[model samples]
Structure formats: C-alpha cells, structure tokens
Target: MTSTGTLSRAQGTALCVGAVLGTGVISMPALAADVAGPASLLAWLALIVLSAPLAGTFAALGARYPDGGGVSTYVRLAFGARAAAAVGWCFFFAVPLGAPAAAAFAGGYVADILGGGHTTMVGTFLVILGLVVTMNWFGLRISGRAQLWLTGTLAALLVVTVVAALPHARPANLTPFAPYGWAGVGAAAAVLVWGFAGWEAVSSLSGEYRDPRRDVPRATAAAVLVVGVLYLAVAAASVLVLGPALGDSPAPLADLLAAGVGGPVRVVTAVVAVLLTIGAVNAYLAGASRLGAALARDGALPARPVRTPRRSLMVVTAGSLVSVTLPISLHTSMLLVTGCFTLVYVLGTAAALKLLPPGWARRGAALAFVATLGLLVLNGRPALLSLVVAAAAVAYASRSTSPKIRIPSSSSAGSIAPKPNTNPVESLP
Candidate 1:
C-alpha cells in the first residue's frame, strides 16, 4: 500500500504539546479554584492517566491507516463514511472557534502588559492571528522548534511560581476543598480535559512520523506526563499562595509571581502568557487547516477552495474571528469545545473497540470513553449544547449525498469514479 501523507515524530509531538499547553493553563485555575483548590490536582492526574491509552488507540489507527484525515480517517475505517464526515465536522468547528478564542485571550494578556486598552487588545489579536496565518500559509517549519522553546519557557515559569509560593501556601486555602462538591469537581474536570485534549491530534499525524507505531505513543505518553505534572504544580502553588484570591484573578500565575518577585514580574509573566497563547493559536491553525483539507478531499465538505494556501489562510482567519466573538466566558468556551471534542473521542474510542477484537485493552478503552463522556455531561448546558450540535452534524453528513472517491482493494494508489449506491453515505476504507 502507498502512503498518502507523512509528518516527523518531532512535528507530531510538537502538535500535541502545542494543543495542550495553551492559555487555559493561565485561566482554568481561576475558574475552578472556588470549587476545588489543590484537589483540582486530582483532576489533572486523572486526565493524564486517561489520555495515554486513548492516545495509544489513535497511534494504532494512524500506523495502520496513515491518511491525511486523522481521526475522521480512523472513523471511516471502523464505522463508515458518514460517521467519519461528522467527526471531521465536529473537529473542524471546535478547532476554528478555539483559534479565535486563543487569539483574543493572547491579545487581552498583551494589553495588560502594555498598560491595557481596547484598541491595543483588538489590534494585538488581529496582528497575532495574521502572523500565525501567514506562517501556516507559507508552510513554516519552525513549529517544532517554537514548541520546544515555548514549552521550556512556560515550564520554567510554572516551576518558579511553585517554588517561590511553596513557603506561602496556606492550609486554610485548601480547607473546604470541594465547595461545589463532587458535582463541581466533575464540572471542572470537563473543562480541565481541554488542557489535555490534543494528544490524539498528535496521533493524527502518524503518517508523518519517522516511526509512528512506536514514536507516537511514546511522545503522547511522555508529553502528557510532563504537562500533567506542570499543571498540578502550578495549580497547587496558585491555591497555596493566592488562596481565595485565585478565583478572582484572570492572570493567576502572574499574580502569584508578582507577589513573590515584585511588580516587574508581571510584565515578564504577561509576555510569556501572550507567547503561550500565540503558540497555541499557530498550532491550532495548522491542525484545523489540515483537518479541513482532509475533509474536503473526502467530499464531506462543499467543493470549495480548500487546497490552496490562500484558502487555508482564509479558513484559519475566519475560525479565529469566531473564536474571538463567541459568547460565554473563556472557561466556559474551553469546557464547551472540550465537550464537543470528548464526543469525538467517544466515537473514536468506540470505533477502536469495535474494530479491534474483544480484549482487556478494548474493555479498558471502553470504560475510559464512558467515564469521560459522563464528565462531559457534567460541564452543564453549554457543553451539552455543543455535544447536541455535534450529533446533528454527524447525522446530516452521514445522510447527505456527495461525490466520493473509492479506494480499491489492490495495493495500488489510483482513485476510481463514484458509483451510485442505495446508501447515500460514502465509505473510505
């Protein structure tokens, strides 16, 4: 069989790291701190444990069928065409909306660093998005190097925050830990999942990896472990030092550092936050653009301009706009998009279970999928709505009539004309 696409192992890992370590790290603690202080560390631990196996499944899928479509390609192989299309659409929506939100967030942080103003905020947002879009359009190779630098910088900042604040941690801040109770923990876990959601996206690039079957899983597990620890350290430190104040501050990390290192630290922290968000936006732009291109190739989307670099730039730009304009708090948006992504994960996990024979591993995957879905529901109305929208899109894509290419049973890589069928949905595998 001929390979249709490819990505290096470093690129794959960068994609995962970029997806996980975004502005959410700076924002999530504040939103969930009121409900679960250091206890939220438990949530991060759970995500790390859960994401590994799910990531392994994606790696396996990618190794076996290294198509450009990523998760949608796996779904097509296991379920059918319509199902794959729906999954693709869900991912497309989530990524684009997420891009703009991240850009806006970075802009907001940049404004803070520059003494703050609406004009600066909007201007920064547009400039950052434009820069990222240009880089992606030009097929930039700096993403991997950028990811390494950004990850190191952010990790150092968290470590410093943790060490500086350790002595100041208040026991009382951790008391009444579950103020919102188990339900609140569950709700926050839903949002927290977003911070750890991109591991599978890495697997989607297996075709590009030097040795996907081995490297993808290793990178995914390692990245999750590293990022998970970083998150826990930051969360614990923020809760210990900031205590009740954690819930009120938008830039909790900066606040913690400024308290320990003086006012100058705020400027440094703000700069890092802006860089963090920009890195995330760039990564998402690459991912979402690739995903859109894959879907268009499959005829799941309209036969529009998807292949050209300019078209891809337009698509990423438009998505960034939506991310900026979406209602609901950033925390809420993270939860909602994450819930939609969780549904994508459920479908993928179920596909893995179905395509693979009955075994202990499959059973474990099924359990994790079910548990994650339960947590997703706990994210409340907005998350539920996102899930509902995803479902509807899947159903429509499955039933709609569209031109499709058929892969022949032979190992050769030629496409065949679409044949009329009683069933409207097209099957890829």
Candidate 2:
C-alpha cells in the first residue's frame, strides 16, 4: 500500500466517495427544493438508483483495462485514438470548470456566514485552488491518504447532522410533496448531476490500486453505498424538517444542524463545507494531473516545455480563477459543471458498450449509455457548449496520429499488456 501506485480498497473507496460528494450536499437540497419542492427527493433517489449501472459500467472497464489513462484508455481500445482524445479532452478540461463551481459554492456559504460578498467568495476560491494544487504537488499517495482522512471526517459529520435532525421531522412535510409537479422532477434531476458525477473519476487511478480487478469494483460498490446513504439522509432531512423553508436555506445543512441541536453548529457545518470542497477538488486534481500526463505521453496532447503534472495543475488553477469571477450564481454555474461530466459519462458508457464482452456486461453498459444520453438531453441548452467542445476535440484528434501505443481491450479477454512506462513527469492519486 505504501508503493507509489498501490492503493488499498479502503483508500480507493475514500477517493471515490470524496470525488462524488462535494459542496453540492450543502446546497443541492435547497436548489432542488426550489425547482421541485419536497419532490426533489425523487431526483435524488433516481440518480442514486441510476448510479449502480453508471458506476458499474465504469468499474468494469477500469477492471478490464487498468491504466493511468483511465477512460481514455477504454475509448482507445474501443474506438481508436481519435475518439479517445476527444473523451480525454472532455475529462481533462472538466476539472478546471468544475473546480470553480465547487470552490465558489463553499465560498458562497462562507460569505453568507462572514459577510464578505464577492470579495470573500473570490478569495476563498483562490485559497482552495492553491491548497489543492499544493497538496497534489507531493504526488498521489499523499493525496490519496489525505482523501481518506477528509472523507472519513466529512462522512462522520454528515451522519451526525442527519441523525440529530431526524427528531424534528414531521409528517406534514410529506403532505405537500410534488407541489411543483412531475416536470420539475426532471429539472431537479439535471441539477443533481453534480452530486452523482464522480464514479468515473477514481477509475483513472485504477492502476494505483494494489489489485485493480479485485479492489476497483469493491471500492466502487462501497462508495455507492456510502454516498447514497449520505445524500438521501440529508435530502430527506432538509425536506421533511425544513419543509417550505428548504428552498431558501442557503446553508441547508447548517440550518438543519442548528434546528436539531441549536447554536453555532451552522458555523461548524460551514467549516465542513470548505473541507469537503478541498477533498473534492483534490481528488479531481489528482486524476486530471495523471490524465494530462498520460495524454501528453500518448501524443494526444502537445509535449509541455515543463513537467506535465505541474503545468496541468497551474493551467487548471489559472482557468478556475478566471471562471470564478464570472457574473453567474453558484447554482447556474453548477448546472454547467453537470453538463461537462454528463458528456464524459456518455462517452464512457458508449465505450463500455463497444468494448465490454457480450451478455450482462454489455447489457448493463447499454443501460448506462441510454440513461446518460437521456440525462444529457435533460441537461438542456447549457449542455450544447460541452457537446460542441467534444466535437471540436474529435475534429482536432482526427488530424493527428500517435504510433504503436496500444491500450488493452476486452476483446483480448482481460490479458493486459505490461503497464506503460508512464513518464516520471506523471503520477496518480
């Protein structure tokens, strides 16, 4: 486990959970509640249920082709280098866009509590970015350990908050459920994408696991359970206890904790929100760093003049700083983040269906493909920009070629090639 790329199942599970649950838990319930009232629970439940097929498809692929390249590896095996590069671009670019949304979310909560408005939010965004970039500079083993610690602390606090708030739940809160009707459920589900979009992330580090085939699936299953319970408990508590007030609660978890135990707990929850954002951002930075290095090694990206990992981290950090300054609310910015990940999921599932063995694996992959496609469509106009970006990547990749670098395929029946000589410039988390 102390080896550079060797992660235990527990550490792998922590990474997946940390990647999935970010600052969204702090505000998603309110955002969904505003869109669909108490019925937002349906969106939460639907995504959790859908996560099985989505997560399973990616885990199966990761187990089959354990590579630093991750989803891009699968896409290469299935569709060739051009499609792989496109999927890789979607994923690599997503971290910068998504990081600002997550950091801004936690920063907004801090602003609400401490009264600094745009100044506080922007400053918090930069600080979170700096901390994550610095943490990742030490490399993946350190970052994975940090993720394990953060996930444990954050999960414990959430469970405690949910348990304390349960006593305040009332039957009347369930009566007016669906006040905005069924269409709103679809709208709410689109927003919940930010919360559900992380299972693919840890797969990029599949090569880091001591036993990829054995540990990767187990870790994914464990993460699904942990994240599902935490999300459902918080959403149910927000709706049933906070009721109509749920929509306007900027710090929903804080309000829930205060109502349950009273006093200063909101500040504690706000602190936890910042830590959760750090964990989430750290996980993405870990994966994206490895991914950028891999892509560069395979000629999908240009060779950087500097070390790939550091350069990628700096680029992402700089982009996030620019993005954080945009005149958009956190909720709208998050929906855009959702669009980016949904496109990644769509490409990943398509690769799964193409490359997985026939029978239940293919069937499951097909189910994931169809479901993600539906969600992409539901994601509406914001998603068009992501789609356009993906098309551009495909066009860009079609014009270029890299030689002799082959990823293992399921067609070869799980006999993997010797691990690629990942440049010393690359590392996994």
Candidate 3:
C-alpha cells in the first residue's frame, strides 16, 4: 500500500531499455546476417521471444525479493554460497569486456562517418571510456536520468530508420536463406545474445523501484516490447534492405538510413551509435561497480580497492582499459562477454525455478534455463572463459575467508570474517 522510491515507472522502463538494447543493433545485424544471410532473422526472433520469459523471471524475482542483492541473492537462496559467488564473478567481470566491445562498435560507426579509419575508432573508444567512467564516479543517477532522454531518442531513431528503410527491402534477398546452412542460425543466435544481455542487469536496480511488485512487472513488460520491436525492425531491415552487402558494410544502420532517406545519415547514425554506447556502458558500469563493492563486503575481493563504489569504479576502469588494450578481435571479445552473460542467465533462471511459486512461472523458468544453457554451448570455446572466471571466484572465496571470526578488541583486532554468498552482482546498493 505504501510506495517510496526515487525512480518513476518511466525511469525504470528507460533503464531497462538502456540496459537491454545496448550497442548490438549498431553492428550485430550485419555480423549475424553475414553468418546466416536472411536466415539471421530467425536468431533475432528467437532471442527476442526468449527475452520475455527471461526478463519475466528476473522481474518476478526482483519484485518478490526487492533487495539490493538483485540477482546473486536468488542464486544464494536456491543453490549455495559458492554458486552465488560464481554468478557475481561472471557479471562483475563480464561488464569490463562488454564495455570495450560496445565502445568499439560505436567507434566503428564514427570511423565510417568521419573517414579516420582505426584512429577514429580508437579515439571514439577513449572518449566514451572516459565519459562513462566520469559519469559513474559522479553516480549513475545522473546517467540514469540521461538514459530516459537517450532511450527516447534512440527508439525514435530506430523506428525512423526502419520505416524509412522498409521501402527498399527487396524480397529477393531472402531467397537464399541459411546461406551457411541451418547451423548458421545457431551461430547468429549466439551472436545476438549480446544484444539481449541486460534482463538480469535490471534486477540489480529493483530495489530502486517505488513499488517493486507493482512497478517491476509493468516496467519490464514495457521494456520487453520496446526492445523486441526495435531490435527486430533493425535486424530485418539490415538483411532485407542491405542484402548480400551486409557482411562487408561497416555501419549497417547508416547504410540502411542512406538507402531509404538518402542524406548525411552516416553522421546521424554515428551519433546514434555514440549515444547507444554511452547508455549501455553507463548502465553496466553502474551495476558492476556496485557489485564489486558488495564482493568486497562479502570477502570475495581485497577490501582496500573495492570497499566503496568509487574505489570499485577504479577497479572496473582499470580492468576495462586493459581489456580494450589487449590484442583481441572484436568478435572474440564479444563472445567472451556474452558467454559470461549467458552463464549468469543460466544461473539466474535456475534460481527462479526454486524461488518462484509453483505453476507457469516455474515452467517458464525451466524453459529459460534450457534456452540460456543452449546459447552458452553455442558460444563454443569462448564460453569456457565464463567457467574459468567462475571457478576463480569460488577459489578466491575459499582462500580469502578465514574459518574463524574473532571479536575486535578495544583497538583494532579485526579478524577475517567468513564469506556469505549473497549472489552479489545485484548485491550492491
């Protein structure tokens, strides 16, 4: 009956949009189309459909629990402390890799428009990296507010892009669907998982909602519709309008924009890419920094650099810089990150099976669990990284926590405390 929250339903919906939409639409269409030709639409549709139950599962958990331990708490309650710690590590580390790949995708769009090649791309990455980091340092409430504006603009642009481009979509392009074979659809779906990552990330913010049970479902439903429609519109437009040239095109959205409403859309699309990247990176950082703080509190990491959100931000910033500088292909980095995200989803949905009341909710969780696990297998060898990171998390926990806790004397006899697996990625305030 009572409501107390700083975020409105609109803001909650906006945050969901920002987190789930991501920069995937900027480049994922062409990459996927290249793999499966017009058949890539299957991947798009499948994942979009899967998002409903996936997001629903999280929304149910968020509303039911309504705590800062957004996702990890559920895993802790369903499984155990170590399993929850693994969830925490998977997400806390996933964002560092995801951020750079997202920035680079936007950078590619800028490079296409400005004609500076890799230099332009690298510069764009640096600018966005610094920008989002600064935003998080100040607190993401500012960034979250901006997300409301960015999501609207981004959605408008997507609709306009699709509508304008639809006239140019040729039926001939779809004739030779499954160009690489039906297996390509699987590959494309695996790639598309990057776009659908933030469903659980929203759970991290459930505690910020005014009426968790009432508003969480409404906001989630709105976000699911918005993301599913916009993404499908963009992906279908890319394959139908761009046809075979999709694979070679560096900026699919800009190309689609040019084909329909021919103009200086490369520049406009570049702007879209930047805004998209900012919205996504800001959301992930906000979530990840808080997760790091919780891990420190829970004894998973050294208490010095992550005891506070600001310090945790530094850790994330440092890890991201290293991730960006490493000599890895954009394709490879994305797989690694999505692999981690899928692992988190597998864990999250499994937790839902236990936490949700019996009935359709539980049935949906079972389906989602299978779906995410299948996607993880599609990640191929890169998915192995998620398992490795998770193992490291468990190992770290085992080594870091002392078996005994001693009372602090009058001075400072602080002893190492036993770690509690609170499923901490959403564990932060």
Candidate 4:
C-alpha cells in the first residue's frame, strides 16, 4: 500500500462517490416511493441539502487531522477514549449489517431476473463478500483505483439512463404527491438515510490523500454534486414515469429504462448494481479494517493474527452471514443499517460541535447533529439497540483505558490521551 498523501483529488472523489452510491441508489427509489408516493422526492431533496453541512463537518475534521481512524479519531480528539471507542464500535459493527444489506439489495435484482429466490441471493451475497474482502486484502491504492474506475462507469450509465428516461416523465404523476401526508415524507427520509450516508467513508481515508486539506473537501464537494443530481434524477423519474407502479417495482431503474427504451434492460441495471455494491462494500471494508487495527493498537480490543487485519475481516464476514438469517427484506435491512451509521454521524457531529470554535462551522455541525438525531429516532427501535451497544462499549472501554495503553504518537489515526487535558482543545493534534 502507498504511504499517506499518495492519493490525488480524483481518487479521493471516487472514494467518496463510490461510498455514497451503493444499494441505496439502486433500491431506495422504490422503497421511498412505497412509503411516501411522489412526495418521496421531497425527502430525497431534503437529505441532499442536509448532506452539505454533515459532509462539511467531517471534511473539516479530516482536513485538520487526516487519519485512517476517521470519525473515531475526531471523537477521540473531542471527548477522549470512552466516546471514541463507542463510535468505533458503532462503525465496526455496522460493516457486517451494512455489507449484507448492500449485497442483498443487488441480489434482489439478480434474483428477480433469474427466479431462484433467497438461494440465489445467498449465493450472490457470498460471492460479493468474498470478492470485496479479497480486493481489500491487496491494499487501499488498488481498492481506491478500482473505485475510481467503477464509479466512472456507474456514473456514465446512470447519466444515460436518466437522460433517456426524462422524456417519459409526466408532470401529472406529481399530483396527489403527498397522498400519505407529511408523516410519510419523514418515513421516506428515514429510508433515504441509507442513500445519503457515506461522507465519512472518505474521512477514514483522509490521510491517504495527496493533500488532505485541499483534496478531501474538494472530493466531498464533487461527490455531493454527483450523488445529489443522480439521486434526485432517479427519484424524480421513478415517481413521474412509474407513478403508483414505482412502489411495487422490484427494479425501479430497470423499469424506468424499459419505459424509455421499450424493453427490460435487467442486464443494464443489474450490472450497475453489482459494480456499485462492490465499490461500496470495498470502501467500507477498507475503512473498517484500518479502524479496527487502530483500535487494537490503542488497546480498545485484543490483537489478532499478524498484520492481516484478519480478525476484523472475519468478524464482518461472519456478521453478514448471521444477518442473512434475519427475517427481513432489502428495504428493512437498509433501515437497520442506516440506523447503525446514523449513530456514528450523531457522535461525530456532536464531537465537532463540542470541539470546533463558536462560529458557522460549529453551527453547521449542530444542525447536522440535530438532523442525524431525528433520523436516528426515525430508525425506531433499531437505533435504541445501537445506543445500548454504545453504552455498553463505553462502560467496558472505561475499564481498559490504562495509562500505558493510551494512544501512541505513531498511531495511524485518532489516539486517546492517557489523561484528559484541561487546557484549550487546540493543543490536541
């Protein structure tokens, strides 16, 4: 793997875009349409608008202190070991659930075209999990480059699909938009959380960028624009082109293409889904593996076999297997996965609010914190369970934070101090 500062802005942007796109783009349109009808488009727009401040908060922190540990590092800088461990736990545990959810969303598309049910889905999940783990094993430079290529191809196909489908969109479909009322909009927003999440993925790779300060924010900005337009276009097309049928569509993008091109292009959307899922899961595996290793080095957990990050990867793989057993569909699984990352966002944004100076930056962070918290609640009981996990992790970590085990100068990301510093927080690195 290349050392820190080796990645260019283009690579950084690819990481961000790949991380943000994923299963959500492929499946969320139908799910949100089911929840809020055409008004789901509003939920799509709202989250895209909110993504700016939320992404900026993490981007600002990454620019200041580039680290592989990402949001966990920012937490350590602001709140010390306990909170940091908890955020790390949230992220670490999220991978297993999110990976399976991502895999399943794409698998659903494949199953639809082939007719094999969960058996096909399980096979798809296993193949995807194995492929991404293997890709990540080679190292980030390869993975990041793969992301750039994957996203480039995914973006081109998506742009073509949206443009071709736009001619089929009818304004009449937008009428009776709020058929389910405003509450439905909120419900739709909760589902869209999966779609909007992923800004922090780039933060975890911040140190790898050629210039974190210059590249990370530029990457984030470019990703925001890319994801925002693509998502809104797809969401709008699903509503206006498919209308009531949008909610029931197993493969909305394919259906949209079929409407425009006069035949099913299951092959087209399915290919996009597979490529997007690979990039998304690969990016998460890379970030989570590094954060896991950093946690081990800092004594948040026990060390494992050699330099392979084998333990963390195994945990994620096993967790995905277990997740497959749950009696949930892709849409529900997305909500549960979104809850996990929303918890991470809440912590990171809260940390920024606490650590940043009293100014627009901090205010933006505060807004993000409140928005994420709202989304967290919308996630319902799943979010509460995540909080319980965090509380337990914090209590356990408190006992392990001995003076000698404190973060060392050589740690790749955020390091916990042995004792809390009473001086101004600016003294922290």
The C-alpha RMSD in Å for every predicted model, in order, reads 5.5, 2.6, 5.9, 5.6
Candidate 4 vs. truth: CA RMSD?
5.6
lDDT of 3 at 146: 80
Q: Which candidate is the best by lDDT?
A: 3
Q: Please write out the lDDT profile of model 1 over residues 1-429, one tens digit for every residue.
A: 333223455556656766777776777777667566556766766766776677666665555555456787667767777888877777777877666556555666667777556677667778777767766654535555566677777777778877877887788888767776676666567767767677555544555455654566666666666676777777777887888789778678788887667657767776777777776776666666666666666667654755433464477578667667656676667666787788778778877776554665577668767866776676667667565666776677766665555543323222222311101011111
Candidates by lDDT, descending order: 3, 2, 4, 1
TM-score of 2: 0.94
> In candidate 3, how many Å is residue 116 off?
2.9
Best by TM-score: 2
Q: For every model shown, what is its TM-score relative to the native structure?
A: 0.85, 0.94, 0.91, 0.91
Candidate 4 structure quality by residue, lDDT tens digits, 3-64: 24556788778888888887778889998989899999999999998998999889877776
* Model 2 per-residue lDDT at 349: 90
Between candidates 1 and 4, the one scoring higher on lDDT is 4
- Extract clashing residue pairs from model 1: 6-207, 6-208, 7-208, 7-209, 101-323
What lDDT tens digits, residue by residue, belong to model 2 across residues 1-429?
Answer: 122355788889998998888776887899899989988999999999889888888888887777767888788777888877887887888778788888877887788788898788778888888888887787666777888999999999999999998999987987677888999999999999988888777777887777778888899989989999999999999898899998987788889998899987767987998999998898888778767766766667774621266666676677777776677776667777788788888888999887887877678889888989999999998887677777877777777676556555454324234354333335332
Tens digits of lDDT, candidate 3, 5-121 = 455678889888988897988988998998888998999999999998999888877777654445765676677667877898899888888788899989988877678977887
> What's the TM for model 3?
0.91
Q: Residue 63 of candidate 3: its Cα lDDT?
A: 74
What lDDT is obtained when candidate 1 is compared to the true structure? Answer: 0.66
Off by over 4 Å in 3: 1-5, 402-429
> By descending TM-score, how would the candidates be arranged?
2, 3, 4, 1
